[model samples]
Each structure stands twice: as C-alpha cells, then as structure tokens.
Target: MTDQVNANSYLDTDSSNICEVLQILGAKWAFLVLNELLRGPQRFNQLQRNAAVIKTQSLTDTLRHLEQNGLVLREVFPTVPVTVEYSLTEKGSDFQTALKEMNKWVEKWGKPQQVNGKTSISS
Candidate 1:
C-alpha cells in the first residue's frame, strides 16, 4: 500500500474496518458503470446498451448510488425526450487509477470460476 492511501483518514483500511464505501462500489454493475464512464460521458441508454448483461433497473439503481456517493454527475438537458448524461466527477476520475491497478492484478492472478454453466473471472 502506498503512503498516500495509508495516510487517508477517511478510509479505515484496517482488516476489521473495511469501508462501507467499498461495499457500495462493489455492488453489482457499479464497477462496470464507473469503468464505462472512464471512457467518456454516456447517456442512460448508451450505458445500458454498452453494458449488455446489466438490466435497466440495475443500471438505474447503480447510477443512483454512484451519484449519491459524489462519484458521478447527472446532467439533464431539456430535449424533446429529456436527455440525461452521466459523467465521472474529479473524485471518480481519480479512482480510475485504482481500477487500472485492479485490472492488472486480475489479468495476472485471477482465475475462472464456473457459475451456472458459464465461466466468470474471480480472484
């Protein structure tokens, strides 16, 4: 762990005090939603389409959670159908560094696990 992360008083990184925020981010589709936003801003339907496995309701719930945590910004434009865009905030953008590290770790150490006859990656 880096000194910066270790010095962050906001997060109790100790094993017994795992942050609740981590649980929120680890929620279904949350990481994927954040990952997609890292590429650029996207509309609701675009996120749904790009994230094929996520249902509409799941995406809605995850977006709400991310927004609540100040990781995402939702902008609504006054269009005919009311276009809504979601983009990462500065905090969220900073989080991408950690995600990139996690991706590297997964690629190196993760193994495939079977779930209902399908292969899924697990560490």
Candidate 2:
C-alpha cells in the first residue's frame, strides 16, 4: 500500500482538504497521546507511565509523529541531563474536545464489549 503521508493531513495546503482530516486523527496512538496530553503537559517518562501498556519505542515514535504533524509540541529544557516534555498544540487541544465528546457518546450508547473480562474503557 502507498503510504498516504501528507496526502490526508495538512489542510492549509492546496494538496489536501478538510475531508481528509480523519487521516490525521486516525493515526495509531494519535488520539491516545492526545487524550493523555489533555490532562496536562508531560515528560516522556510521565507519558509512558500514564499510557501504561504503550511501549517505549511506540510512545517515542508517536510523540515524534505527532510533533512532526504539528499536533504536539516538544520542549527541551536546559538541565543537567536535559528534559523533554510534550504538550498539545492549539490544533491538538481542539482535537481533544472531539475525543471527549466521543467518550461521552460511547459511555451513553456504545456496545459493551469484553476486554480482559471487563468492559472496554473500564477503569
């Protein structure tokens, strides 16, 4: 399959349109990381801890991908060992509102699916 890359993202350009926005949001781990950042900005380790089952490589890749896509911002602090934190950009924060609405909708009428013997999205 041909990798879509910017074909689906980047709405401000002539190459794409708003209709393709889902291609950006639907990226793997995109929404998950966005949801975590919705709580607040976090260091890489903190993000890893909060995301739980996500592997280090996966988190790193996702963060890099999000940053590249202009959805997440990465700030590097000047310190002894240096610290890096990730937070959502304005576009990303806007996307969080959508995810929150989806969560609310899911809670209201989403089907009950078995996940590890408990309901999916169960805490």
lDDT of all predictions, in order shown?
0.87, 0.83
Clashing pairs in 1: none
Quickly count the clashes in candidate 1: 0
User: What's the true lDDT of residue 11 in model 1?
Assistant: 56
lDDT string, candidate 2, 31-93, tens digits: 889999999999999999999978999889888888888899999999989999899999888
Runs of candidate 2 exceeding 4 Å displacement: 1-19, 113-123
With a 3 Å backbone cut-off (N, CA, C), the pairs that clash in candidate 2 are none
lDDT of 2: 0.83
Q: After superposition, how far is residue 44 of candidate 2 from its true place, in Å?
A: 0.2
C-alpha lDDT (0 to 100) for residue 38 of candidate 1 = 96
What does candidate 1's lDDT look like per residue over 1-123, in tens digits? 688776775455563355565776877888899999999999999988999899999999999999998899999999998999999999889889989898889977789889999987875
Worst 10 residues of 1 by lDDT: 9-18
